[model samples]
Target chain A: MEKEVILQYLPLYREALLLTLRIGWQGVLLALVFGVACTWIRQLKIPVLKSLVTVYIELFRNTPLLVQLFFLYFALPKAGIRMTPELCGSLGLGLLGGAYMAETFRSGLESIAPIQEESALSLGMTSMQALRYVILPQAATYSISGIVANVIFLLKETSVFSVISLMDLMFTAKDLIGMYAKTLECLTLLVVFYLIMLLPVSVFGSWLERRMRRAEFGA
Target chain B: MKKNQLIAAAAAAVLGISLLSTGTVFADEAFRTLDEIKESGTINIGVFSDKSPFGYVDENGEYQGYDVYLAERLGEDLGVEINYVSTEAASRIEYLQTGKVDIILANFTVTEERAEEVDFALPYMNVALGVVSPDDAVVESLDDIGEDDQVIVISGTTAETYLVKNYPDIKLQKYDAYAEAKTALENGNAAAWANDNTEVIAFAIENEGFTVGIPSLGSADTIAPAVTKGNETLLDWLNEEIVALGEEQFFHADYEATLLDTYGADYEDTLVVEGGAVGTVETEAE
Candidate 1:
């Protein structure tokens, strides 16, 4: 690999990395909101909304991100639902991430024993009170590892945002390769930048998982 | 801990040695010569499967276009079968450099930047940048483009380079595929789409409600075949073949066979380059 080319393109890769982080975290935030909402709906047995959540989760989870992105960027504009590339990218990532996040949270919520809710209810606490005070905290601990995995998964998915022309790290690498034909140098830089963006999240994820396990299990 | 350190050190040394050996393998001869290609009995030729008129796959799943026609002839004369490799604009150079394909006939416009990496053969066609936009808001010149409006371009094309280099302030929405760029223009996501004049002209003719407002944007350039750098046998043969075909006006026939239906008669003289020569016919006609 050519060290000079990698050094020269470092600033460009840095800019792309920042954009990726912005979009990735935004998507993860949206995913959290959507996942919690959907999980509550399913848990509380809300009428028509529960089935809709089920369908939404299945649909987004089943298809590839590339197809969803193409439909959003190209097909949606035909129906007068035009969006900027950045908006389209974050929304696509969010929608796809939401489904997985909901599934993860549901599994975590299911792991809670029914007796905990029963005990809180018999103690004169309302169902909402029981859920807020007795159930969600434990579920949040259980879901930590899954949430971290989903966040990293969504961040990696940002690589496909280049199809809609958002100038992410992959786009920058490809554009450099096209213009200069320095494949090895550009690809090496791509790997280094992605590791820089993802390694911290991955490390923190495992740390958080370990801490949550220890806290709940009484180390 | 001391034993662990020794194991880690040994692993690192093994990895370092392996990487050095692979580096030496890469430093050896990288490209295939003409005789080598003949011995294989098949030459891999890269062409765009989406960019119609120049290179594209037809409804029958057969490759048909101006470049494909020339590629077929090259394969026939070399007594080898042709292996058509579909290439994207950005991947064209990568394909050549990696020996993924022996030649790229992807309507590749020759430029100084690319010439440093790949050896270009004689010219087969002439091209210049053009802007195609909605008839209502025709982009007549670069100065008329609105500040908020974006112009679409395929990634790695000369139009993208020219606009980014000269008109840095202009917003560009770049796609990796011709079909995607066309779709973007149709969706009205951009004010205009800039590409080779030949492609934009064909787009205007084939599709309704669009016009080639800026018929020519930058300096005229030639489109040619490109091979891996230092592949002198193939390069020399291509030059000779082009000069020989000039005597028979081969490219004109190629135009008639593939491009004429899309480009029509008026573009015949201006577009086709017979026998590696540029501007000769126009000068003679004048």
Candidate 2:
């Protein structure tokens, strides 16, 4: 309740807020690249590779992010590979997010009618060309919403990076609580920072969904 | 076509059944506190692998520190092979409770609440809550810290609990392990870091431009070896080991061997607890 207390802890919160944004943005970028690549691989219909992708998705998705993070940050070093906390957190989020996103994208690719691909092929388009011009254009609308959703998810998930000692928002909030012994204020600041990052993404997602609906219904 | 679909469906059903059964079988064989450990002939002792002078791995990738030294002694005393289970400050208790480790000797402070979930032996060492802050903007005392300032503390620590109870006005940032807490302090994410005085002092001495402020706080609590609750046999043996070790001032030797560098000339009397100096004797009846 004291103004002085809040005023004193402002720097910690500021730094934490920045860290959250940095990690969230980096995670989202990494997720997009991996997600797209994994989706492409699944589309290829390779005999054993498809099953391998399935296993990767199932393994990462079914397990808790905290456990995966511990494995990356703590266990891996003992096995002789060392990484900074930021690298560990970003890579972990990317790999996990990529699995979930691949499913979203696979569904998006399936939603496009076979007629589109067939038509592109008749026009002398190669498989990659058909995908790039015909399938992807149609799939983008459906995929956009999923991508936005995943970004938000990645943003929230980045909070767990604090477990490995990244100075992200949650870590800063916790530090603030310890320094001032004010749990409520620190938690409030954290919630507010999260909202600040996520609200725009949610709004953009809604706007994109509406635009896709308008395109579908010829509005 | 219909026959092929049927075959596929049957294969899917079999796979699903096997997956479901696998989970149950694995769960049924989950590690038991005593049986699995004894059969393996190696007792896993979880200790902090980053909190120096307690449990930290050195450059050689070997586990070293005061806790490691004590853990080696405990294994020798128990006549069991020792398998060091490196843990962070936050996961030490979880590691013990989940049977990942047979015992935890991670400079874990004994408290009434934690004692309910995990049994504690007689105190082997004593610890008090403390804080470390950057020397340039040092926190001389608890009152000097501002509300907006974040104090970093490792999660699941007595310092975290103490700050939450007594300094309810200050903001706390908690990391799950010492590695994270130290990084946060280094990155200026927190204005100060709080933990056991021994740890804070060690950190301050090792790193440049950090000083221990509020060097001691709350009540001085004993650090003891902990096992999962209901492991009376293991608990009994640990208490006996602590007493037997105390009789010969083994902890003093431990301090001299492992902690003397960190504490140096001035801190020997203040920081070191000679054996038999703290905690109650474990009687057979209770």
Candidate 3:
């Protein structure tokens, strides 16, 4: 790996990094919204909508993000539901991540004791008030680890955006390798950039998990 | 205690032997000579399995096209069975450098930059960059490309290099595969597609509502077989084979057999190089 080549390609990597962060954050935001909404519907036990949410979670969880992106980008254009590559990429990530997040949130919600709801009702709190004030705060703490894992998974999934010509970091690395045959240099830069993007999230997640555990157990 | 030590020695010997055997297998793959290939009884020739009329797989899963026709003849003369290795546009050089394929015949256009990486054999066909676009909004020249319109190109191709260097103002949407680039064009994701003249002409002929608005965008270049950098024995043999094949007008016959249906007679004289003689055809084409 030559120093000159790494220095020269740094700008391209920088541009790709910005694009990746933009799409990744947007996707994670959508995923969080979908997760909370789906969990609320299932918790309320809505008649038809609960079954529909179950079907959606199963469908998205069973299929890969790559197939979903291909369907949205290539196949949907035929049906006149065209979306730009960036939109398709984030949408695919959001839909896939939502299924995993919903499951994570549901497990957290299920862990709450029945006495907590009963106590809230005896205290004259409505069911909605109990869900908002009593259960959700506890569930957020319980679900932190799983939510962090889903966020990291969705961010890494942005690598496949190159297939739609979105020019993410992976695409830039591949294009440089193809044009110049600088495999060692391009791949070294790729690993470094990905570490730069992912390590912070991992460290922060660990810190948050420890804090939540300490607060809950008081030991 | 003695028995345990003896068993340990035997296990270490087995592991050493296995490692040495694997090492030799890798050593043999670094580079192979003409004689080495003949001894193997199967020579791997890399060609494109997607780019139609030049190198592509047909309905029966058999390789067919202009490049494959020549590859078949080379295998026949060498008395070895041909092993067709499908290659993409970007992996051509890496395939030759790594000894994954003995010869590459995937519409490989010779350039000075590429020649430094791999040794190119004598010329068989002449080629230049060409641009194809939709008929309703034809792009007659580079100037016609608007600021917002992107030109589609395959990654690592000569067209990509030329456009990036010469027409810096033009935006390019690059794809890794020909099929994807074609799909992008069909979907109207770009204003025009720039590729080899032979390919663009073939596309314009095959697909309706498209025309080759700009023919011959860059300097004329030759298409030839490529081998590893220092494999003189194989390189010499390929050059001699091309020259000898020229004696019987082999490339013209190849054009008739594989390219005639797509190109017709008009492009026959302009494209095919006889007897590895690129100069005569180069001048006439110019």
Candidate 4:
């Protein structure tokens, strides 16, 4: 693997990195909103909406993200939806990540003692106020690590968007290999590039986990 | 009543904006004409990014090849900035059909089914199926294909079509991109690789101990620039451009500049179609 080839294509990689982040993060933000909302709905146990949320979680989690992405991109266009590649990618990630995030948040929410909710109610707090103040704060602490892991996975999943022509980092690296036929060099560079992006997130995840642990345990 | 009318007008405006955002769903807006592309000051032309001697990028990261040279010429003649959209053999027609590219110069072979999906300009080059194998185990015919041995092909390519139709029993390893197909061939994962005759020949010449045993497998086909079906204005312009390009023997020049290293002088005249004007040699090269 030549350093020169990687260095020469740095500008191209930078451009692709911007595109990948744009696609991944837009999906990440949407997933965050969807995950939090769905968690609340699932916890509330509304009749029909709860069942619908169950279906979404099961469907997205069970199926491959690539298949979902392909459906959103290629299949929907046939039905006259005609979303652009970026929108399709972001939406796909949002739906897929939302499913996984819902489960993560569910576990965190489940881990909290039920007595906390009862205590808030005893103190004349509304269910909404109790959830927002007492339950949610603890759940956030419980699920911080899982949330970080999900976001990182979501970022990596955006690489598959290139199959639908979204031009993420993997797509650019594949194109470079196709152009130069330097498979090893370009792919090695891609590995390094992804590590560069994910390392900080992992480090911060551990730091946040430690801080959250200390806060919760009073240590 | 006035307040009601204002509310109705606001609703109508919202609906109109929503329609405008997803308006391309309508079939009419699925394709753009020459006028529209010219108005935009850029023409998105699909060309190969990895296939050497046709359309490939150089060490400088700039797109170059025989097809790239032609597309550049077309862009110059039309006075539009050519935004080169890299494409593969399987995706060329879809690229045009979906309006991702206004034109495709990606070593696209003129085929009846493809012609139904996209309009082809006059031929600029020629192609046929060719198979390359290791020198020790050269495959001269389909009969030479072993029961378990696989022939590697890039999906969506004519060579894949030819092989599947003629020799259904042969195990086939398919890849979508040239890099993967070539890598599969190099890895000895497959007995041989079959592709465009020009590509096979070039590959054999470039790589030692590889030979184009079946140099010509399918009927001769012409390579042409293609636009979306019914894109007559652009098609006519491209046809004219090809004719104009031929006046200077431009394809021969393209061959010398881009293809000479791989194909040499002997294959130049046979491979170059020269804008449908010169009909000298049949595409079957020995």
Candidate 5:
């Protein structure tokens, strides 16, 4: 209710913001690894492995993040696979993001021509070298926007960590409401905090898109 | 490391992951006793991080509340350090059963079903369900509740359980945290919030344009400390601690220090349970 009280809680808010960012970035990196690896396997037409990748993506994307986080935080611990809240939060976000990111990577990878790979191979390059140098780089340029979008979604999805008691930024706001009973003020602060965090990444995403487009299309 | 050694390590890790499905780390863990905790010099106690006036984090970023105050005194009396583990309402018993916390002081209400799973100490506080709503559309009683009217209840609280069993027709909007439930009530998404009487009373007192219409909905119950089943030594120590604290009128002091800010002087005598008097005064079923 009071501005002074809000000001006093700055340290708590800062700590929470750090946690949210930590989970968000770790999750994004993990999603990138999963998305690119699955896309590569599917493109290579690995028989059983491709189907397994498809299964992983479909299963995670279809289920709710709340249930996934709950299973990791509550149920798995009961089964002796004890994990910290941070691990659960990041892994859940990563798994969900990886599913969506894999789809984006598929579309991007499929758009590049077989000629691009054949041409690189003719120039004394191995098939793996062709993918690393010619094909994957072009695919990345095509899919940077999609990757950025997935990261944005991942940032918001981390709020579900509060349900499993991860002490992220949203959980800190909930605690603020409990202490001060000022839902309006606390929520306003929360909105502003999120905007401050995500808006920059969104801006950087557009910047990267423009740079990549010019690099591809310009002389 | 060499390439062959690296491959061997990775294979080992993968095998370990596969083996976990058949193992249970907690199923064999022995229930912790007071002596073990005293010898270790630190006792893990689970307390809420969101519920107001009971166990909640303050602006100072430190956990300070009624239940937290009790846990601190308990640690001091037991000659050990208190490692406060934050727990949600739904996770309190799970925290005990999994050996995550040695004691749970998260305002656990003593119930017959819960007793089968965990041991309870003497009652420290009394509680009953209460409904709070906007002043203009005050929900005075459940009898007047419309079929379409939505009631907000915290997911794991006794209020949700009571309403579902007794008034199955009334629509309920369940939330996992007090903050979300209050937001639903204030945003007009729900007609009223049903929670513990003390929480409802504190909300109405602290926030404007809200009123506690149905202050006592169900038969009163007592909140007490809980531990894992078969941890009788710890439970007995806790029982003796409650008696000692009562002789010193420690609960009254706790009321003055933590609860008086929200509740004031009125309900002190009834709310503070002395010497863990186990049950409520019997009421004819209504």
Candidate 6:
């Protein structure tokens, strides 16, 4: 590849990297919020809502994320719901991540002893207050490892956004290969880019898992 | 306990019915192409943003090329602001079918298989398939390629399909877009790259030490603007515009101005389409 072409590609790669990070972080935030809400709804033991949550989780979890993204980006607009590619990607990732996160939080909530909620309630605390002060604090500690892992999954999932022309890192890499005709160099750069973004998340997840394990054994 | 189970079954049945009803409602709302363009005021014209001399970005970071020039004219004709929607060779049809773009001006070659899904306007340009290889390589014909030799082609292109069907023995590496396929060729991932003669010639001219070995493989196929099927009003207007432009040889001027650099002094008559006129001379006489 010519030095000039490489130079030209750098900006596109940078933009794509930023897009991936943006999608990943946004999906993580949405997952956290929605996951917590879904977990709490399940905790309420409302039979109808519980079943609905189950269906939602099963549907998204079982299907491939690419199909979900295509549905959001291509199908939704046909129904008069127009969204930009970035929004479609993030929303799709968020919804899919939310389903997985709900299951993660559910497991965390289940691990917490029912006696803790009972004790808080006996002390004249309302259900919401007990959830806020007593239940969530413990659940967050248990779910932190799962959330970190989910973030890694979300980072990889952002690649799918390129199909709708979101200009994420994979898209940029593909573009570079096309424009410069430097297949190996462009692909190597993309692999390095993904590793740089994701390695830290993987390490963090491992560390958090260890800490959680230590906490459990200590108790 | 029995009552609770009965209530749960009723709830599940209700949920199933509601979901089915919502699905039907969505199905009933047919997507209209004209309505979408009018609503947005931005007519999405799918053009290849990477194919040089046809559709590519200039140094000024503007989308300026032959295809872009035509797309702008179409936008003006429609009285809607143009939004250049970049597409790869493979997904251009998907973009049109899914209503992501109103029309595809990408270097789209007309074929019978493609015509079933989308309607093609009169031929704006004529193109033939070609192959490019490194100058050091001795690839005279498709037969010269070894059984192990990998040929690079842009995914979802007629070249890719033709090679696979005609020469199944030759290995092929398909990329999603033109840029990737070219890169694959440059990096020695493939022995040669097959695409339209116009694109291959442009590549050979711009990049040193490359030559188009097979300049014209198939019969001349016309490249044209395409839209989703059943849009009679839009289709009729486009057909009229093509025939009108053909009378003055406007598209030839377009080729001379934008493409003559890549093609040079030779092959102009054989390679370039002079006018936008449609209909065989025999048919016209009848």
Candidate number achieving the greatest TM-score relative to the actual structure: 1
True-contact fraction in model 1 equals: 0.49
* lDDT per residue as tens, model 3, B20-61: 445434534556899999999999999999899999999999
Complex DockQ per candidate: 0.39, 0.10, 0.16, 0.04, 0.04, 0.03
Error of 4 at B261 (Å): 1.2
Model 2 lDDT at residue A56: 88
Docking class of 3: incorrect
Best by DockQ: 1
- The window of 10 residues in a row where model 4 chain A has the poorest summed lDDT is A175-184
Clashing pairs in 3: none
Single-chain TM-score of chain A, each candidate: 0.94, 0.90, 0.94, 0.93, 0.91, 0.85
lDDT by residue (A41-159, candidate 1, tens digit) is 99779879999999999999999998999999999998889998888888998999999999999998888899989999999999999988878877878999889989989999999
True contacts kept of 5: 0.02
| Predicted candidate 3 versus true structure: per-residue lDDT over A51-99, tens digit per residue | 9999999999999888898788878888888888889988988899889
State in Å the error of residue A54, model 5: 27
Candidate numbers sorted by TM-score from highest down: 1, 3, 2, 5, 4, 6
Q: Write the per-residue lDDT of candidate 4 for residues B7-81, one digit (tens) a residue.
A: 654575556545543543442246678899889999999988889978998899899999999988888887899
Number of colliding residue pairs in model 6:
3
- Lowest-lDDT window of 10 residues in candidate 5 chain B? B19-28
Candidate 4, residue B147: lDDT: 95
- Shares of reference contacts reproduced by the candidates, in order, are 0.49, 0.13, 0.22, 0.00, 0.02, 0.00
What is the alpha-carbon lDDT for the whole of candidate 6?
A: 0.74
The alpha-carbon RMSD values of the candidates against the true structure, listed in the order shown, are 4.2, 11.4, 7.4, 17.4, 17.1, 16.7
The models' CA-based lDDT, in order, is 0.87, 0.75, 0.86, 0.79, 0.79, 0.74
Clash pairs for candidate 4 = none
Badly placed stretches (over 4 Å) of model 6 are A1-215, B1-41, B274-286
Which residues of candidate 2, in runs, are more than 4 Å off? A1-137, A141-156, A164-219, B1-39, B274-276, B279-286
lDDT of 2 by residue, B1-286 (tens): 3355446545755565465446434533333445556667889888877878778899999999888888999877767799888876556555655567888888877777676556777776777888899999999788988867878877667787788888888877767777767866876667899889988988899999999877988887777888876777777677777878877878878888898888886766565555535634231212
